[model samples]
Target: MIPAKADIEAAYARVKPYVHRTPVLTSSLINKHINAEVFFKCENFQKMGAFKMRGAVNAILQLSEEERKAGVVTHSSGNFAQAVALAARTLGVQAYIVMPSNAPGVKKEAVKGYGGIITESLPSLEDRERAAVEIKRETGATFLHPSNQMEVILGNATATLELLESHPDLDTVITPVGGGGLLAGTALAVHYFGNRCMTIAGEPFAADDAYRSFHAGQIETNTTAITIADGLRTQLGSVNFPIIKELVTDILRVEEAEIVDSMRYLWERLKIVIEPSSAVPFAALLRHKEQFRNKKIGILLSGGNVSLSQLPF
Candidate 1:
């Protein structure tokens, strides 16, 4: 079920002590470049260096004592793995992460540093799921989807809730789409709290299942995951897709080059390090410049987990 405003509120209260209240930053130069007043909710500075911490903490905290004893398992490429690992460590629970073998080395190291036991799999969704299931069976771990659980979705909404609280007058809010957790949560927050703010999603052209799904009125899978935004390669799940379809105003697709350019631009202009997935929204704004001209928009900078050796710029 889609979590209600009350659920989001409770999640925020539950996770408040654990996660950082990441800042809302404005860049005059970016505003001028886009011809709009832009506010960036910098989740790049969040705990575990990403917004996933909120969801991870919320999910872990909701577990029963018995369940906590068994611990939790989840499959993720990077950010969510580290988030879950850190949250579990903080809560005195074990975390088992099933990661693709091709995931960035830095991110894998971060997961280990956060006390996660890692199981590597081939870079395929099927392989990742199989590994997670095997781990769950062996360890009796509760399987938590990185972005599809109700608690996780509400947890993600807290970031948008915080954003709208700080900028109630925003006409629109934008976030990058992957498994739809953050975007769906942003939609719910805007629906419940904003003064008529609409939610738009920025998606990569290479991993454009979200854009296609938004238009097709059903979940769509990518034929190939070739995006530099490795975090965005996953398809939408059953739980978050309906919420996204109903509440999101639009999904804009940006090319790989645009994502890379936007990532570099944000780092150079705002002096903030944002990964390619986080840059997708800004790239969309640039692609549809005239549509949002002279409007107040809020962008969720989703995360800052990037490999220095693989800098797109």
Candidate 2:
């Protein structure tokens, strides 16, 4: 179910103590090049190096005392794995994470650092979910899907809620659509918070299910996700798809090279270290510059958990 406006506000309040109020930033150079005033909500600096922390914390905190005692479990390729681990540790609950064997070493290490018991699975979403189900059955831990749960969606909205609070007049907001959680939350936030501000999602051409889903008016899954933006690889969820189809203004696709160039541009120009997934929306904005001409737009720089050793550049 879609969260009410009050639920989004309450979510902000609930996660406020646990999460960082990430800064809203801008680049004069980016503005000149795109001919639009762009505000970068730097969630790369968020706790766990991503916005997933907001959802992770909110979902875990909503569990009953009995549920928390049994602990929580999730499947993720990276950021959400670290988020649940760290949030569970901070809240004094055990977390068991089923992570793909091929997940980035940096993220796997972070999950361990946060005291999550790790289960290795094959490098497919299906395998990851299966492993998580096994862990949940064995440990009696609650399963927290990274993007589908309603509580998680409400939590993800807080990031854009903060963005809208800071810039109430934003003409549009863009997010990289992976599992559709963030984009759904952003759309809901814009609907309830913004003054006619629209929502758009940037997606990789390689894993463009969200794009196809939006146009085809149904949920679509990718057989193979081969993009450098690791975080933007998951398919849309049932819980968020209805919200997205109704509220999102458009979905734009960008090539892999464009994703890389946009990432490098942010690195050099914004002088902020952002992961490739964080740059997809920026690439979309630049690619469709004519649409945003002179408008005030906001882009959420999603995360910064890249391993410097493996950068494409």
Candidate 3:
């Protein structure tokens, strides 16, 4: 079963000692352009530069003494990799990370900085998973799914929980969907905390598995992950999909150009750095601006871990 409201509340309390209560910021210019008030949950300012820290911390905190002794392992392209590594380090647990070779060098460096033992894999979901499984089997470490684990989902919800606490009047929440962890968790947060707020997801058109999965009423896989939003390349998983399919209002997708332009657009206006993945939701909001007319919107700026050399600008 999906996590109940009490479960999410408890997770928030459990994570407080480990994570930051990130601020929810608003831009009047963005509101003017979209014809609606918008609140940006600045998880980009989060520790390790992403919301994945919340989940990774929660997932590790709940582990038994024996599990912690064996350490933790996961496979992620960027944000979650850094999150897991940092969380494990914070808790004095060994972290075995399987990362795709094509992941940003900055992220790879961050993982190493957090003391994660890295096993490089070819840039594919299969290779990443295989490497993680091998490490888990070899070291007897507990494997934490970057997005599919229930503990991770509940941990992810704390971001939106904090958002609704700051701005309770929001009518809609927009999340960038990658494997549905944050989207599913955000939907649950709105369901439990918001005053009838609806949840939507923004995805890259090139890696539109979540968008396709939402409409098709089933899980879909992307054969090719060629988008600039490197963080959102993963596919939806069984654990988060049910909550997403039921509670999320829609999945809005944008093209590569929109993603890059919106990334820079917010950078210029908000004067804050956000990755291309963070810009997807803003692009979708502007693309479908008419749908949210007069609505108060909440967008989660997922992360800010970009390689300086690989700036898409």
| Residue-by-residue lDDT tens digits, candidate 1, 89-156 | 99999999999999999999999999999999999999999999999999999998988888898899
Please list the residue runs of candidate 3 whose C-alpha ends up more than 4 Å from where it truly belongs after superposition: none
What are the runs in model 2 whose C-alpha is more than 4 Å off?
none
lDDT of 1 at 245: 87
Candidate 3, 121-155: lDDT as tens digits? 99988899999999999999999999999999999
Model 1 clashing-pair count: 0
Worst 10 residues of 2 by lDDT: 1-10
**CA deviation > 4 Å runs, candidate 1:** none
lDDT of 1 at 111: 98
Residue 299 miss distance in model 2 (angstroms):
0.1
Q: Model 1: what TM-score? A: 0.99
- True-structure RMSD, every candidate: 0.7, 0.7, 0.7
Estimate the lDDT of model 2.
0.94
lDDT of 3: 0.94
What tens digits encode model 2's per-residue C-alpha lDDT throughout 1-313?
6668999998888899999999999888889999999999999999999999999999998999999999999999899999999999999999999989889999999999999999999988889988888888898999998998888888999999999999999999999999988999899999999999999999999999999999999998999999999988799988999999999999999999999999999999989999999999999999999999989999999899999999989
